[model samples]
Target: MRRYPSLVMLMLACSVAVTACKPAPQAMPVDPEPAAPATTAAAATPAPVPARNECPYPKFDAFLKHFGNEITLQEKATADPLLDSHIDAEAEPEPRKVESRLALADVEWPVMPDPAALAGQGRELQVNTLADGQRQVQIRTPDSSDQQTYTFAQAPCWTLVKREDESI
Candidate 1:
């Protein structure tokens, strides 16, 4: 897929924003009073370590940069048997809601739109971090109902799990 100038600018801006918003590492405050020594019994029993999500690249912005630009990375990051939901345009009298799974082998490459291309075509792109912690990337034509939303979840690392096509 060709890279558009607008898309490059968008990604660059996102990168800068993410970098700018990161909090600087601060030095741990020094305690005037020393912490109490643990008892021998307490030392014998090791404190339980909290489990953590170990995804190397946990930031959605970074993941999205690759997702839009690289097909192989997108395929690898997407969930297998992806949940695809949309209106079935083939219905006899009227379109009907349909839900299906697209196995990794069956998925058409580059399902995601290039934001630059969309902008060039006079479509608008909106990205939101939903209340439920999922990220939604939506593209639509202004003043029109033509829209699609791609929902992603951080299953350890970001993964494209659902797509909702609302376009007519």
Candidate 2:
């Protein structure tokens, strides 16, 4: 075996030099996660309930009175996709009832007449409760052929679901 003292010393010197020139080890940077939005009293509040589920009036009569006058209340009291029926006098066969579903946007407002004001306007208004607890309101002119019937059902509160216009 041959001993290379100079070679060993040279290798040791090179290793020391390399170690001295090398940069110190550093910890990797970490990014923090975003925080959630704060929940205040207003933010934590529940969504508004539908008008059909709320009954501010004790009787149907009072509800109808307010429903006809207030446009906002009337819109809320009316059902979406309302069932609209009218006589189709121009049908191929004899005149027949044409039924169509009308969306909230398509529905004409103020279709209902206030019972209290009907008599004053020289129009007769009759409200009858059906066997199924639905209110049928019939509005008619004294001698004119104009007439309209509105049907309201109470699921949790009175809501106008259907309208039949027999007026020519």
- By TM-score, the best candidate is 2
> Candidate 2: where are CA atoms >4 Å away?
1-54
* Tens digit of per-residue lDDT, candidate 2, span 62-142: 988888788787788889989999988788768788899989898877768667788789999889999999999999997
All candidates: TM-score:
0.62, 0.65
How do the residues 49-160 of candidate 1 rate in per-residue lDDT, one tens digit apiece? 5333555457877777678778877788788988998887788799887889989888888968766577779998788999989999998998876888999998667889
Alpha carbon RMSD to native, model 2: 9.4
What range of 10 consecutive residues in model 2 has the weakest lDDT sum? 28-37
lDDT of each: 0.80, 0.82
Report, for all candidates in order, the number of backbone clashes. 0, 0
- Please report, as a residue range, the 10-residue window in candidate 1 with the lowest summed lDDT: 28-37
Give me the displacement of residue 55 in model 1, in angstroms. 4.2
Off by over 4 Å in 1: 1-56
